[model samples]
Structure formats: C-alpha cells, structure tokens
Target: MHQLRTRPARRLVQLYAGLVLYGLSMALLVRSGLGVMPWDVLHQGLARQLGWSLGTVTIVVGALVLLAWVPLRERPGLGTVSNVVVIGLALDAALAVLPEPSALPIRVALVPLAIGLNAVATAAYIGVHLGPGPRDGLMTGLVRRSGRSVRLVRTSIEVAVVALGWLLGGTLGVATVLYALAIGPLVHALLPRLSVEVPAARAVQPVS
Candidate 1:
C-alpha cells in the first residue's frame, strides 16, 4: 500500500527471503536456550516429545494450522503455502549451523538479534501482502468469526499455546516475554517501510 516494489519477481524474492530470515531467527532464538515465539514453543515441545527436529515439528504444525483455516473459510495463498515449507527448511538449516552455547552471556546476547531479525523478517513477508502466516491467519479468522477483539483473540490463543508448550517441557523465559511485548510494535513500525504496493488488477477494455 506504500511504495511500489512493483516488479513481481522482486516480490517473489522478498517473500522467500523473508521466510528464510524468519526461520533463521526462530532457530537463533531457540538456540539461545531461552523462550521462543508463542507458536514455536509448541513446536519445540512437540519436537522434543516426538524425537523430531524442531523444523520438522514446525512444518507439521503449520500444515495442521492451515487445515484449521478450512472451517474459517480462509484461503491459502502462495505465501501461505510457501510459509509452511520454506521456513521449516530454513530453520533446520540454520539450527544445524548455529551453536548451542552453554555460557549464559553468549546465549543472552542472541536475544536482541533474534528478536530484531524476526521483526524485520515478519515485516518483509507481510509487506508483500501475499498472505499471513498460518498462526496469524488463525488469529484474524477467530477475531472475524467470534466478534472478539484482536487483542483478546490473540492473547487467549497465545496464553493457551504457551501453557501447553510449558507443560510439554518447552522453555519459557524472559525472551518469551520480550518477544510478546516487542513484536507487534516492531512489525507495525516496519511494515509500512517495507511494504511493496501490489499493482491493481487491470480493467478489461471494450473491443473497438
């Protein structure tokens, strides 16, 4: 809705690049050995429980979330399906390379970088306007269908998710709190700057 990064190819590049960055950020946050994003907490828990890689769990969960969209009558766009695939592969790839530091200070340092990068990634993907992440779609759908405020719907879902994740042995720490408080503001600030205006559909002209 802002500046036109009008080239379709560029938008495609942005979409995939943003997705990769988003996955890398998630991996970094998890490696910090602190809390992760709300949905990722569940992913991590399931990963541990099922003896699967975190990225594998993430993809499965994403698919299931997409399935939930059916009841809400929400359609999956190219970005949505790509979000389910590219991010998981990218996450696992990053996790393979990122270290698990036992030292507190090193782990602590990753927090800001991970969170900031995640925000940038989120903005980049969302700015292209192809579609929302599955979790985001779920929240928006619930808000529309239930007549609840976005705040209420999002918070309720996150709280429940976090609770389940914690019970299932996922980490929950200050980083989780930091992510919750900061992400919305970060995305809000960055989206406009990153946004690539979509070209309007061309109108049909009458035959001469």
Candidate 2:
C-alpha cells in the first residue's frame, strides 16, 4: 500500500481517468439506444421504474451491493469508495452533455466503441490494484465462498441480472451479448500490459 502511495500522482490520475471514462462510456451506450452491460441493464431498469437518472440508480445499487461485502469479509480501498461516488457523478455529467443519436448506423457504431472504451477504462482502474468495484467484488466474494470458478460465478451473476433487468423492461439486444463476450477478452489482454505492480517488499499488503 505504501508503494501505491509513493506514486500517488500516477495512480490517482489513472484511477480518476479510468472512472470518468467508464461513466462516459456508459453514457455513450445509453445514448446510442443500444443495450448495455448486465449491471447497467439493471440500473437502467431501476431508473426507469423509479423515475430516477441512470447515475442515481447506479450509485444506489453500488452502495447496496457494498453492504454485501460485510458478509463476504471484503474490505473497500480508496478506489472502491471512489468507484461508488465518482462513476455515478461522471455518468450523470456525461449524459447531461451528450445528445442521443437517432440514426441506426450511428447507434450501432457507438456500441462497439463504447464497449472498447469501457474495456480500456476497466483495465486502467483495475490495473491500479486499489480494489475492485462493488459489483465485481460481489462476484469475486461469491466465488471465494463457493469455491467456484470465476467464469461460473461471473456468468451466473450476469445471467441473473440480465434476466431481472429484462423482466423490468430494460433494453436487451445484440449489444448486450457483444459486451458480455468481448469484455473478458479485452480486459484479459489489457490487464497484464496496464497493471502497475506493487513493490516486492510491500506485496504482503492486501490488494483490497
């Protein structure tokens, strides 16, 4: 952790930039009128049903999900708490500024671009190694407790969320499926290259 603090400027920039870009990417997808990632599907549904903005729903859901960490014995780091607050704020801000596109071709184009930006943003923040976001931590926690493979746990959770979100009237389409399939590979490829390793002596500190 000390090593993390030692290069505060770089880590902080990476963390905040990644988070801001993540929010912007989400806004892009929403504005494109295409499907979003599973958790965003839930957020969009809840926002629609509750007459709230997507970002408001995201923050609320994130906080609620964080509560599950107690039972899982997961501890939040600076990035974790920042993820809860910053992403939502940035999402709302980006959504406010970005206009929705009407053309089908433009909307379709936006999906892949948004997904790619999302993957890059995800890698940036995660590579900092401060902590996983609340929803991700939940999946990882479940994996640890159940001794299941990450693929199984992640797939199960995503399936449940997508089903529930669809039931609640969230948009589900090819974009959602694309995001699910592409994100894993994108993150996998990016993480190794982007990750900032901690010092060997300070490696004993918990990542989260």
lDDT winner = 2
lDDT of each: 0.85, 0.86
* Ten-residue stretch with the least lDDT total in model 1: 199-208
lDDT score, residue 28, model 1? 88
TM-score of each: 0.92, 0.94
The collision pairs in model 2 are none
lDDT of 2 at 137: 87
Q: In model 1, how large is the Cα lDDT of residue 60?
A: 92
* Candidate 1: pairs in clash: none
Q: In angstroms, give how far residue 25 of model 1 lies from its true place.
A: 0.5
Show model 1 residue runs off by greater than 4 Å: 1-6, 199-208
| RMSD of candidates 1 onward, in order | 5.9, 2.1
